[model samples]
Target: MTEEPVGTLAGIARHAFPKAPMEVLDHVDVSVEAGLAGDFRGAVKPGGRGRRQVTLIERGDWEAAMAELGHAIPWQERRANLLIDGLDLPQVAGTLIGIGAQVVLEITVECDPCSRMETIATGLKAALTPDWRGGACSRVRRGGRIALGDDVVILDPLQGQLL
Candidate 1:
């Protein structure tokens, strides 16, 4: 029998420039050389394919943070490239996140909230902290088209699933 997906890609977003408002998309292109299409970070970065290529946040965690702050801000304010639901992202470095059947990402580090977060709301940066509420930073290992509702999976690197 086929295994059930752990979660679905709940949201997709991109930005035209740094510190610019995030533009939510129904679908996007992922690249090994340039992270997410239309995202300035991917094209502006010096080199192709490294940590911070993509940023993802858990839908539940974002809502919890918002609730704690008593603000009904949109998730796009998080400035994350993707939003996922149903799975808690692993904190361990080297964990793999698979999108759909082709795109893969290697978790590199915690995506810490910056001072900009505080500008959005008082204590937003703090609310996004404590147990990785800021989401995850990852490098694109494999690239392809990714769309909302695509299957998301956490893969075991040791099982020869690195591809």
Candidate 2:
């Protein structure tokens, strides 16, 4: 199958609070069981099924969202695990994205902005509404360490099939 287009991992952020400032990190560990190391979402669920092991946002989308709001806002305020560049983060579910050398994430759903966003900035929630601006929630498939500047690759299931 043909390989999907490549992108870049621009940044990484995580926080312990549901509505607190995200702490940017140079590198973070990702695993099927715990998600990002120390990330709040890593807490085990009773059934061992958590779709939000990690979250990712496209830098382009973030910039567009900010421009639509008429100002710049910190990336941390979005509360995503990774900020990616040069990829159009498909809104479709079941998409698989490979981060760095070993981490693989299956896109589960759109990460809708919550009321907490409004707390981060006025009009923030509304600003993040269109074009999957808020980002995507994913579950870790294959776990590994991810760092800034890692290669982001999309894995299209229909790669070699005739449409």
Candidate 3:
């Protein structure tokens, strides 16, 4: 028998720049707990076999992460490939992030951090905000893959609650 995940899709990558190269992502990972991420892959680029990873942005770490890339890009100004505003990964593992008439996803395993984040956003270790900053990444369990301009909707919340 298998168990189900919890939580819902609060928000998705507010902005997605599919055209941008992997240099944009400082770090990527998967998370399980409520406030902390689980595992991470760091950068999002070429060279992954079957294990894909999710990118993450620490609170104040965004600035430093951007700097390491030799660009003055601001954190808020960045267009992440996939943005999740709220909702815990572990809590909402089975939930789906619904977009208008297109893609949806079931919460898979928690995404943890990889090497890129350690190098770029070292400050992230100390700057993680509970409510703000940024949420973690997720694997697309169902529906089509997400593209730009897709609207996200949370299918559930903590304890099957809806907001």
Judging by lDDT against the true structure, name the best candidate: 1
TM-score per prediction, in order, is 0.92, 0.90, 0.41
lDDT for model 3: 0.37
Residue 130 displacement in candidate 2 (angstroms)? 1.0
lDDT of every predicted structure (CA atoms): 0.88, 0.85, 0.37
Tell me the TM-score of model 1: 0.92
In lDDT terms, how accurate is model 2?
0.85
Clash count per candidate? 0, 0, 28
Residue 89 lDDT, candidate 1, scale 0-100: 84
User: Can you give the lDDT of residue 41 in candidate 2?
Assistant: 88
Give the per-residue Cα lDDT of candidate 3 at 18.
36
Off by over 4 Å in 3: 1-80, 85-91, 128-134, 156-163
| Model 2 worst lDDT window (10 residues) | 154-163
lDDT of 1: 0.88
Model 1, span 49-153: residue lDDT tens: 478889999999999999999999989899999999987888988999999878988898999999999999999999998899999989888899999999888
Off by over 4 Å in 2: 1-4, 157-163
Better of 2 and 3 by lDDT: 2
Give the per-residue lDDT of model 3 (tens digit) for 72-140: 544433333344333233333455555335444445433443343334455442333333233344444
